[model samples]
Each structure stands twice: as C-alpha cells, then as structure tokens.
Target: MRVLVVSAPLVGHAFPLVPLAVALRDAGDDVLLATGGGALAAADAGLPVHDVAPGFDFGRIALRVLPRHPLVARAELAGTAGTRGAGLLFGALNDQLTDPVVALADRWRPDLVLHEPFAVAGAVAAARLDVPAVRQENSLFDGRELVRATGARLGATLRRHGLTELPPPAAAIAVAPPSVAVQDGWPMRYASYVGGGELPSWLREPGERPRVLVTRSTLTGPGDRGPMPAVVAAAAQVDAEFVLVRPDGRSARSLPGNVRVVDWIPLGEALPASAALVHHGGAGSALGALAAGLPQLATVGPGDRRHNAELVARRGAGLALRPRDVTAEALTRLLTDDGLRAAAGQVSREIAAMPAPADLVPRLAALV
Candidate 1:
C-alpha cells in the first residue's frame, strides 16, 4: 500500500507521526511526507518528503491571523474561543497546504492518508481522492473538536475540490496516557523522535550529580529564549547539572557554572541519562518526559502549553509554572520529590502498556 502522510508546518505537529510512518514503511508500505516550515526537519528521520508549501512563511501567517483574535493573541482562548482561534490559525495554515497536498495525493494515488490533527488538509486531499484518512492525535487536546472548528475556514477549499464538508477520519490513533488525557481509538505508545544530531561524548553517561534536561520550543526564533534564562539562573542555585538544549545565541561565559549547553540532541537519547526535565510544555516534551519516567517542570506558554502542563501537574507527574514562577525551589523539586518520580513512573508504565507502533500496522492496513 502507498500512504500519504500530511502534517502542519511545525515539529510539534509533525514529529509525533514519525514512529507510525516508520512502522508502516518497515511493514512494506510506501510512505511520503507532505509538510513545510519546522516540520521539514522530519526528513532527517530518513522519511521521503514533499514540501507542500514551497517558500511559505507560517510565522508570518500566524502573525497575521492571531492578532485578529485578541483572546487567542493573549493565549486566553478556551472553550468556544479556543475552537474559533484554532480554526482561524490552523485553518489558514491548511488553506495554504490543501491545493499542493491534493496535487501530490492525486499524483501519488495513495491508498491511505495519515495526518496529525491540525493537518486537516490531509483529510481534504483524501476525500478528493476517495481514500481513507486517519487522524493521529499528537497532543492532549480533542482532535475532533479542532477539526470541526476548521470547517468554516476550509469551505472554499472544500468547494474547490467538490467536498461539501470534511469527512471524519476512518480511524484515530491515540498515544496519550489515560492518566493524563483519556482518548478513544487505537492506543499506541507515545514514542519520542527528536531528529538526528551529534551526541556529545559527555552525555553518554550520568554526570557527577543528578542531571536535569532543559529545553525550549523549536518554533521560536533564536532570540526568543522563553523561560530558559530563568531556568539557567535557577540552575546556579541548585546542586544538579543542567543540560540546556538549543540555548541559541547564549554564550558559555554567561551561563551558570553547573549548566552545559548543546545546540541539539534527540530526547530519546537524552532522557534516559537524565534524572528530570525542565522545558516549555510542548506536547512532545511533556509526553517524552512521562515516557522516560522523569519528573518534569513545564513552564507554561501560549496555546496548548498550558493545557499540556496542567495535565502533567494534575496527574502528579510534574508541575506547571508561569515563567516568573520558575525558580530554584521548583527546579530542585523536579529532581528530589519522590512522589513526583513515582507518579512519572506510573505514567511511563501506562504508556508502555499501549500497543507499539509496529503492532498497529496490521490494523491500519485492514482499513486500507
């Protein structure tokens, strides 16, 4: 079978789909990835890719769409407001992608289409080609609700392609642990894929003290060091070694004595060696920490970060702190709190109990 995989132009939207795509490929299915922006990094995982939106600027689109909705701009979008914002933002993204993705799908003649929730363009293209499309949840939010909200924005695109409305996916792939977010559909273990990078020799083993892994969002500009400086400052007061990922333009001379910086490394490689994690509450980072059984401190940011962080805290696996609330005490608790560690371990076990990606290949094939 030939499968066409579609993703929004962000790593948070793209990377989560990698494990399943790889599993399908290993099972003798041909898989082609269609995406843009930060998601282009997925090619580093060795998947065949087609850029659906050549020279598209998603950041610019976000800037144009977000401010039009004040609540969304402030990250206060929730309930109906959240749904509207998701439509305006992700709908705009899909609008740019729909034509190109449909063209690609028309040429590829895929038997199945797999997509992250935000990449509704995949669903559209699949409908156009009269093929089965599957929704893969990559975060804690409801994929159905988000997709429903995108309907109004996609009307023109749908009309252009002879679709009255977006069809529901043939099936859904659920990865979040039930303790954090209860979801329906085939349960697959959340797998972390942080792309390829050179691992520093020092990272191969545990450090002299407990190691705390710290990271920020990949979507931000190099100058936007959200909550990282505070985490680094708190590292100076703690006894543990801090490994900061992609610290961007920050220099070694200005960093704390106990902090180490790496431009990039796979979290799959970094988590096992670390005692705890500190990061902006991206869906990928939060799930990666839980899968590793590591206590984490999720500094809440805009959009789904708050939702992801709150779920982590409510489940007793971690804490959600505002940027100003990030301090030495919270950082220390991430390493020293036994209850947090235990809860994290429990979540990890729950994740482990889910079906592996390879195990779901036959089920997806049956759909085809």
Candidate 2:
C-alpha cells in the first residue's frame, strides 16, 4: 500500500506522526511524508517525503498569521478565543497548504492518508482521492477545535475543490495517556522520534549526581528569549547537574555553574539519567517526560502549553507554573518531591502498556 502522511510546517506537529509512518514503511508499505519545517526531520528518519509548503517557515507563518488574527494572537491556552476564531485561523493555515497537498496526493494516488491533526490538508486530499485518512493524535491540543471553529471557512474551501464536505477520520491513532485527550481514541503506542542529533558522549556516560534536563521551544519568535533567566535561577538552587538542550541558533545568555548546554538531542535519550525535567510545555516535551518516568515542571506558554501543563499536573506526575512563576523555588520542589517521581513512574508504566506503532501496523492493512 502507498501511504501519504501529511503534517503542518512545524516539528511539534510532524514528530508525533513519524513513528507510525516508519512503522508502515517497515511493514512493506510505501510511505511518503509531507511537510515544510518537519520535512528534514522526517527525511532523517528515513521516510520518503514531499514538500507541501516550500520556502515557508513555521516561524514566519506564525509571525505573519498571528498578528493578522487577533482572536488567536497571543491567545492563552484555550483562552477567550472561541472555536470560531480558532477554526478560522486553522482554516487559513489548512487552506494555504491544501492545494499543494492535493496536487501531491493526486499524483501519488495513495491508498491511505495519515496526518497530524492540524494538517487538515491531508484530510481534504484524502477525501478528494476517495482514500482513508487517519489522525495520529498525541497532543492535548485538538485541531478539530480549530477546524470546527472555522464555520463556513473550511467548507467553503472544500467547495472550491469540488468537495462539499470533509469526511470523518478513518481512525485516530491515540498516544496520549488518559486525562490528556478530550476523548479516548484508538490506542497506538507513541513511537518516539526527536529530530536528527547525536547523543553527547558525556550524556551517554554515567554521572555522579542526579541530572535534570531543561529545554525551551525551538519555535521562538525574534523577540522571544524564552525563560532562560528562570532556568538559570533554578539551576543555581538545585544541586543536580543541568543539561540544557540548546535549540538551533540559541545559546544561553547566562549559565549557572550547575547548568551545561548541549546541541539538540532527543529528550528520550536524555530521560534515563534525568531525575526530573523542566521545560516549556510543548506537547512532545511533556509527553516524552511522562513516557520516560521523569517528574516535570512545565512552564506554561501560549497555546497548548497550558493544556499540557494542566493535564500532567492533574495526573499527579508534574507541576505547572506560569512563565512569571517559574523559579528556583519551583525547581527545588520538583526535584525534592518524592510523590511526583512516583506518580511519573506510574504513568510511565501505563504508557508502556499501549500498542507500539509497529504493533499497530497489521491493523492498518485493512484500512489501506
């Protein structure tokens, strides 16, 4: 079977879908991954790929789109930006990518289309081709909310392509542990895939002290320096060694003695030695920490970060702090708290019990 996997121009969107694509490839299906920013990461993972949004960067799109759309601009986690506003914002994004994706799908003639939720282009293309489209869902964020919020915008776009409506997803490959996703989806174990990077030699070797992993979002805007100062303060308060995973073109402005920086590495690779994690609440980071059995402190940012932070906290595995409140005190609590670690371990066990992507491959044969 030929599979076309579509994703938005962001790694945060694409990374969650790669595992399933890889699994399908290994099962003798031809898999083609489509995206803009995440195309490199997918290629690095050995999947064949097509560019749907050439020359368009996720950062640039965020800057351009957010300013024009006030309902979504600086919208807090699910803030007053109702579904309609989110839907319109999502509609425009999907609309921008739809033509290219549809063009690709028309040529490829894929038997199945797999997509990260935000890439509604995949669903549209699948509908055009009369093929099944599946959602590889993981994040607490739901693209459906944004799509549903779109009202006539989405349908109108569909009508332009000779399509009157979008069909329901053939399946949802759920990866989030309970309490995170709004509804339970068909279970597919998350197959972890962080972008291409080598694990540092020092990180590989055993260490004397309990280590803590720290990271910031890679999708930062020009003015966004992120919470580096808070991380520095937290490092100073903790006795543990801090390994900061540096995002591209970003270096620590100031580093505490306990904090050391390394180039991009998979958070999964960093998890075993990590006693705890402190990070901006991107979906991948939050879910990765839980999968690894590490306690976390999610510094809430705009978008789904708050949803991720709140979900983990509700499950007793982590703490959520607003950006202003992320401090040494919070770091100290995350490191010292025994209950958090225990809860984290418990959730880790639950995640481990789910069916891996490879395991789910046979089930998808029917869909194809």
Candidate 3:
C-alpha cells in the first residue's frame, strides 16, 4: 500500500505521527511524509519526506489570522474559543497547502492518506482523489470537532478542490490514553520520540537529589518564553535538582546552584530516572511523562496547553496551574505527593496496555 502521511510543519505536530509511520514502513508499505518547516527534520528518522509548504512560518500565519478573529486573538490560545481560533487558522493554512498537497497526492496516488487532525489539506487531497483519509489523533483534543469547527472557514478550499464538505475519516489512529482523553478509533500505545541527541553523563545516571525535569514547548513564538522565567525564579526555592531542557543563555543567568540547563536531551531517555516533571502543557511532554509513570506539574497558558494540562489534573495524574500560579510549593508537591504518583502509575499502565503501533498496521492496510 502507498500511504501518504500529512502533518503541520512543527515538531510537536509532526513527531506524534512517527511511530505509526515507521510501523507501516516496517510492514513493507511505501510511506512518504508531506510537511515543511521544522517538521522536515522528521526525515532524520529515515522516511522519505516532501516539503509540501516551503517557507511556511506558523507564527507568521498565526499573526495574520488571529487579529481577524478577536475571540481567538484575545483568548491567548486558551479555552474552547481559542481552540476554535486554532481551527480557523489551520483552515487558512490548509488553504495555502491544498493545491500543492492535492498535486502531490495526484502524483503519489496514495491508497491511504493518513494525517494528524490539523492537516485538513490531507482531507482535501483525499477527497480530490476519492481515497480514504484517516485521522491520526496526536493530542487530547478531538479531530472531528476541530474539523467541523473549521468547516465554514474551509469553504473556498473545498470549492477549489471540488468538494462540498470534508469527508469523515475512514478510520482513526488514537494515541491518547483513554483515561486521560476519550479518544476514538483504534487505540495505539503512544511511544514517545523526542528526536535524537547525545546524552549527557548526568542523564545516564541517577542524580543525588530527587531530579525534576523542566521544559517548555518547541513553538513558543518569538520573544515568548512561556513559563520558563517563572520556573527559573521558583527553581531556587525548590530543594530537588532541576534539569531544564534548552533555555536560552540569557534566561539561564541565575545562579540557582541546584538547577542544571542542558542544550537538549531526549525526554524518552530521561524520563525513566526522573522523579517528576514540570513543563509547559504541550501534548508531547504531557504524554511522555504519563508514559514514564511520572507525576507532572503542567504550566497552563494559551493554545491547547491549558486543555492538555487540565486533563492530566482531572485524572489526578498531576496538577494544572496558570503560569502565574506556578510556584515552589507546587513544584514541591509534584515531587513528593503520593496520590499523584499512584495516579500517574495507573495512567502509565493504561497506556502500556494499549495496542502497539505494529498491531494497527494490518488494520490500516486493510483500509486500502
């Protein structure tokens, strides 16, 4: 089977699809990834990739589209309204990529077009070719709702592609743990892939203190550090050793003797030895922590960060606090709370019990 996979041009957006894509490839199917920008780095995983949207800057697109939609603009990427705004912005982005993606699909003629929820261009291409479009859920939010919300905004693109409406996905590949999010479709165990890197000696060995992993989202826009500054300020008050991933040197100026800043390390590799996590509520970070059975303290803010953070808290696996609410007390609780630890372990086992990506290969191939 020839499967064409589509994703938005961001690491957080693209990385989630890697496991299933690799599964399909190992099963001997022809797989090609269609994305651009930072997501193009997915090529390092050994899959053939095509840049469907060259020179695409999501921050630029967000700036242009957000102002026109005040509800989304003012929401600071929080709440249902903010998510709706994201749907519209993604719709606008799909408008730019539809023709190219459709053209690529025309040439590639994939039997199945599998894509993350935001890449509606994949849906358009599938409609244009009369093939199956499979929705791959990479986050806690439902793809169908997002696509439905985006419907009106997609009028022009649908018309251009000779489609009256977007087709429902023939099937779905859901990765979110069921307890954390009520995801639909075939349940596949989420295997976290944080890309490759040289591991530091400290990461390979257990730290002397109760180590807390601190990180932020990969897409925090220009000049926006999210909650890192707050985390840094509070780091001094916490007694545990803090390993922060990839903070700018300027942000690292503080002499917090307990804090260690590394340029990069794979979360998948680091989570096993860590006691807890503190991060911006990116889906990747939240899921990775869950997979490792680590309690989390997710700093909620704009976009789907709040959404992701709240779900973890609702399940008792962690705590969700606004950036301003993040403090030393919260960090302390994350490391030492017994209830959070048990809930996190339960969620981890739930995730581990889900079917592996390889188990879904036959089902996906059968769709063709």
Worst 10 residues of 3 by lDDT: 220-229
Error of 3 at 285 (Å): 0.8
Q: Can you give the TM-score per candidate against the true fold?
A: 0.95, 0.92, 0.96
After superposition on all CA atoms, what RMSD does each candidate show versus the true structure? 2.0, 2.3, 1.5
RMSD of 3: 1.5
Model 1, runs deviating above 4 Å: 76-81, 221-224, 251-253
lDDT of 1 by residue, 1-368 (tens): 99999998777888889989999998999999999877888988889988987886766887899777777665533222456667888898888889999999999999999998889999999998888999999988878877887767888989999999998889998888988997767899998567878888788788999999888888763223456888876778998999888876653448888998887787778788899988888888999999999999987666677788899999999999887788999888888899999999999999999999999999999998
Of the two candidates 1 and 3, the one with more favorable TM-score, higher being better, is 3
- Provide backbone clash counts, one per model: 0, 4, 1
For candidate 2, the per-residue lDDT at 28 reads 90
lDDT of each residue in 1-368, candidate 3, tens digit only: 99999998888888889888998999999999999998888888888999999999888888888888787676755544645777778878888888889999999999999988888889889888888999998888877777776666888779877988988899987889988988788888987557777778788777888998888778757324656777778988988898888886666887488888887677788888889988888888899999989999887777788888899999999999877887899888988899999999999999999999899999988887
TM-score of 3: 0.96
The runs of at least 3 residues in candidate 3 whose Cα sits more than 4 Å from the true structure, single-residue gaps closed, are: 79-82, 222-224
Tell me the tens digit of each residue's lDDT in model 2 across 257-339: 88888887877886887788888887888889998889998876666666678889988899988766877777778888999
- Candidate 1 collision pairs: none
